[model samples]
Target: MIRYINIKNIFIIYLVALIIMVVLKGDLSDVLARMESIIEQRNEGNWNISLKPFESISSVLDSYNRFGVNIVTVKVAILNIIGFLPMGFLLPLLKKNNTSFIKTMLKCLVFILIIEIIQFIACIGVADVDDVILNLSGCIIGYIFYLIVRPVIKS
Candidate 1:
């Protein structure tokens, strides 16, 4: 039997997958240990937060220069951008009547911020401004692609 998937369903699936990939990343078995470690560190007044934008990008570039290409760093940088592309594309597609670019970008920004906040609170990942920048860039690039393909899809 042929199956059909609607945009809403696709978007929901994508969002869940994205959350799993970002928030629930790494070995699940050690999550409790990691959380306890983070809590202890926090009790010691040590927080994992990076507010400096491009600090991560610069570190990645520096690593590339010094270590002669690190696949992990490259993968992470690329993933940060590529991951959010669907949000930009699918959100507008879902809201056909209100596909305003500004509004879409604002929504994407809010979503990214919420994810970052979760990361900070849960200590699952470093709450870095660079991630926000890169994710937003990906969203914008996705929106651009949407603009390019919108006409074709409409026909």
Candidate 2:
């Protein structure tokens, strides 16, 4: 129905906007300038990609133990999880085949992997396996949420 489509479109827009925010998390006014800077960094070999899952987390823990400063790490971890939670739930709703749990999760992992790779190559952000873990966890949480809410909405 038209009504369903309108709502679905609105949700799609919101999901896309949220994903952009989750990835960029920065000023958009000078996107070209920012991208140029990133490109420059890439050329200059300012490359930073991390495969170690707990390296940042360990440093954060160390910082917390030494200086009682955790705002940066804690906030980032929480935000990463929170940001992807909606993706988990929304993807299932948006994709017909994604209703299956394992299929949806595998798809989410692939999607997140691609995003992380782009961030690394583009110099937009650090590529971290820890983030993948946390983001995947968030998506699973979202799937749980969808499972809880779907029946209620249908009935």
RMSD of each: 2.8, 3.0
lDDT of 2 by residue, 2-55 (tens): 646764886678667866875677777555566677777768976557898878
Worst 10 residues of 1 by lDDT: 1-10
Q: Return the clash pairs for model 2, or none.
A: none
Error of 2 at 112 (Å): 1.0
Please give each candidate's TM-score: 0.90, 0.78
Candidate with the greatest lDDT versus the true structure: 1
Off by over 4 Å in 2: 2-7, 28-46, 95-98
Per-residue lDDT tens digits for candidate 1, residues 1-155, read: 11124888888999999998988775786666667777888889988689988999999999999988899999999999999999999888886678899999999999999999998888877789999999999999999999999999778
TM-score winner among the candidates?
1
- TM-score of model 1 vs. true structure: 0.90
Residue 110 accuracy (lDDT) in model 2: 95
